[model samples]
Target: MCAMKYGLLFFVTLMATNLVSEADGDLMSMIDYRYFRCVMKREWKCPDSEINFFMYTPEHPRKHFIDPRYPKLLHDFGWDPMRKNVLIIHGFNGTYSKSPMTFIRDAYLSRKDYNVFMVDWSELTRFPCYLSALSNMKKAAQCTAQLYSAITQAGALAKMITCVGHSLGAHICGMISNHLTEKQYKIVGLDPGRPLVSAYGSRQFRLGRDDAHVVHVLHTNAGFLGESGLVGHADFCFNGGQKQPGCKGHIMRIARCSHFMSSCYFAASVRRSRRLVGIPCDTSCPKERGYWGINPQRRAVVLGDDVPDGSRGMFCISFENTEDCPFD
Candidate 1:
């Protein structure tokens, strides 16, 4: 088991190191990595991760999964068609019960009367074998699309549905949006994973700006787990999207803590409480000017899942490392 795990890790390590190797002054193409990917794909055969959806409402705070096949399951569960729906997708090794996921879910439920559903695919996204989990994201997204389809057919409004994903789960939501012919109301990517994904430009595998009618990305750990590229209509970076506040000591601890802050900041944003403010810009702002500076006039977009539309391009907001309040 150790050998198998390390073997997979070796391939990932090699590809990551040589992400942009040069041959005769020419950038070596992705074909070089394809061989190892093929081997992993064929040998592993990609796990068909089951996508589970749990719905929550103010009346009944307990999370429950409603089967779309029954159509009436949602109605029976006290789902209000009038209320807008938001589906939450968790990242690698995450589940419905986890911190960021549950925190974000409860935060939304605490303030709004919207239908909140948490999408769990933790079985396939177990830790240590991220390669397998990354490949399985597509299958999981397809399953989610089918599930969403069923739900919408059952009287849920597709036009009113908003899907939010954190880490690799963000990419999964992107894939789900890509798979469906109809664009979802909105897709919010909270720090989309960078490793094994940042190198690729394929719209099929990675999230893109056009995946949904309105795609917003919050980069709390950008250039690390979060892709640094501007891949959304509005990409908001809090504290430059790395080395987040309250994450101190040790490299790994800092990275992990900062990476997860995207969700925490987002959860707080839903209630519009002490939200990090961003200023709109016709063109992208210089890195030094935004996020790092505490200019209220420069505020672009409020940090969270509920950003109002109108502005485009990247935005930034600053906060101290010890400050729990986003902009304070």
Candidate 2:
């Protein structure tokens, strides 16, 4: 009987393994199609703690590197102190080399003579270790805050600096903004990562609404990678902040689709002049189901790079699968 039971168990395990292996290709292709080139490799080794900054300007619109050690490196990089500065922070398991990060930098460089900085902390954010990456986020935020201070002390205006962070990177921006005394430096959090941040409610570690002068959060994958609760001055939920339009198939793709849409919409907003129309709702309203309401008296506002000053409160936004111009 023992021999028979052992053989049966081995057979069951083999079958399960074979099934998973067979479906692996389909799952990966679906994920790639919806995520727009995501690398889901398992990186077990701990990455080094290093932050890289890629700067881009109108004069040298291509791309340039800046050392955080030398605060005056901006001058050598030909940074324009007059133009607005945008610092983009990528999420867990992501680097500045990723399409979203580069796309954002290019979009800003193409639109105006703004100084776009890409913050790469991939060393500490390797894949399959999201918990480790979440813990290291505080360190990343500390490094970023130091860099921000150094840059301001050298020449750049603190008010002109706008930090844009996606997923876990968004929370890092919030932590950085919290440490900075300058209240005018806005933070645009693109679907701040939900899992670990919400699990630990300690205010010292999580991103709050008043972390910056104006904390604007865009929730595209709430309850998944994004925190469902409103954690910003203005929280905009796109497509009810759950399953997005473009993503279908596997469960993983569904979760990632909306989470990534936050960055996609923000990137598109940089080059496109047309803004999205958002409908306002009561504070007690459910954000995930915000689209099925009727409140015409409330004025609609843009939710991205073109958002006007003093656009406060929560709102619901809808967009087409391809772009933000077309509303649902």
Top candidate by TM-score:
1
- Quote the lDDT for 103 in model 2: 69
Q: Which pairs clash (backbone N, Cα, C closer than 3 Å) in model 1?
A: 220-241, 278-299, 278-300, 278-301, 279-298, 279-299, 279-300
Residue-pair clashes per prediction, in order, are 7, 0
- Which ranges in model 2 have alpha carbons more than 4 Å from their true place? 1-49, 284-294, 323-328
- In model 1, the Cα lDDT at residue 164 comes to 89
User: For model 1, how does the per-residue alpha-carbon lDDT over 1-328 read when each residue is reduced to its tens digit?
Assistant: 9999988766674454232111111124433544343212323221233657778998889988765556667878878888878889988757767776787788888876788888888776654445666787887787778667866876777767878898888888888876677867688888888787866537778877777878888887777667885778888777766667787655554666777787887887886766677655332322443334334454456666546654567777677745442210
Model 2 per-residue lDDT tens digits across residues 1-328:
9999977754542332222121223423332332322232243222223766778888887678776677787888888777888889998767887656676777788877588888888876654335556667777777787768767876778767888898888888888865567653688888887765677646757667767767888888887668785788777877777777876657765666667777877777777754766677544223535344545676787766667657766778776676432111
